[model samples]
Target: MTDWWLWMYVAAMAGGVALFTRWRADPRGVPLSEYRVAIAIPFWSGLWYLVMALGGGRAEVAGHTVYWARYADWVVTAPLLLVALMLTGTHSLPGRRWRLMTALVGANVVMILSGLVADLTTDGTARYTLYAIGVLALLVVYGLVWGPLRAHARRQPAGIAAVYTEAALLLSVLWAGYPVFWILGPSGVGLLGSTTTSVLLVGLSILSKVGWSIVDLGRLRALSDRGHLTVV
Candidate 1:
């Protein structure tokens, strides 16, 4: 397949990085930590997509070309995205929040790594087994977001609570589709070709990364303008 999709993803990610960075310049009452992760998601995605477009970070796995760079990007960006969502909910919470954030990050990392190994495996049994593990880890992630994280958001003021709710729900919904794409794409049953998979994956990535962040940060900005957000 042609690499034009990869190049297009690179441009999309680059635009995301620029847009988020510009939003970060006047963060108002929002914390720099939020902006830091927001900027990072697209920054890393763009960088890795650039590498993939230039014909780097690919390898033959199970007789199919695997873009390992894509996994590398996910392993980093996924956790950052999760953390950004966490920070939105827990930023104003009292006491040590790092423990929960750490747990979420760890589970997310396991999920990404499991998927990577599954992609690399040539054996059907091993591949599906790893995919199952990844799915388990993913369930844990959703549990935390919809469970404790949602509770935390509810404790916030109405506006902040609304922002967190929207962000978390949007992210969780987008994430639920990744496993389906994985199962159908080259890494699994090959029900979808690499070209179609790449298109869908890129669409998902843009929505989860750039689109989600804009919805999130924009709401936070509105809250800040209204003097409702903490000076975090």
Candidate 2:
């Protein structure tokens, strides 16, 4: 009923619709793996939005009660999905590498669980541990999967290069933005801290995805110019 709750619901519905549209469109013309990962974007985004909306319905914090689920979804779940999409989307990656992809997804699952645990735990230490695990999982994803994919993208066609570059930039933004927001934002008791952190993270995550879409569009334009593909 509150403004924060209203924002959360709206964000969730919007994200869900966007993701569904993306899935239905399937514009990439890539493998199933890529589609699988891509489909997750909206679902997770919506879920986080819903969670925050419900959890902080009438809660107040630091002069406001902005829904923070958007941040959490963006920072934690969205990144995991993005990384998965990138890895699977890479032209150079072999099918056998899917095992690694699966592992990465599993790590993301853990991160999601960690977040939930943090939310549920009353003890400060336990919550922090869960948060730490979520952070570490993301780090591993960057170090192991995203790192190699970036290198491969650099060597691929300009279109691929553009996509990967955009992805990299998005990841970098997410990596940098989250901690800064958390450290500087208002601190309060109960759901406020985690929710706020989540909202900030989600904003960054959306920014990164938008960046990728822009880069991909540019790459398409370049490719069209080269006469490799006809402009639609």
Model 1: lowest-lDDT 10 consecutive positions: 90-99
Highest TM-score: which candidate? 1
Model 2 misplaced regions, further than 4 Å: 1-40, 47-80, 87-89, 92-96, 179-202, 208-232
lDDT (C-alpha) at residue 181 in model 1: 96
Reference-based TM-score, model 1: 0.96
When summed lDDT is taken over every stretch of 10 residues in candidate 2, the lowest stretch is: 183-192
- Model 2, 1-232: lDDT tens digits are 3346446544654664465456446444443444444446655666665665565423443354444454466555554555644652465544445555566667656655665555455566776677778778767766654566566666666665665666566665555554455434432234445555555655565555433443443344345456533211
lDDT, model 1: 0.89
Once fitted onto the true fold, the runs of candidate 1 whose alpha carbons sit more than 4 angstroms away are none
Candidate 1, residue 90: lDDT: 73
Residues 81-148 of candidate 1: C-alpha lDDT, one tens digit per residue: 98889888976777657777888999999999999999899999999999999999999999988888
Give the TM-score of each candidate.
0.96, 0.61
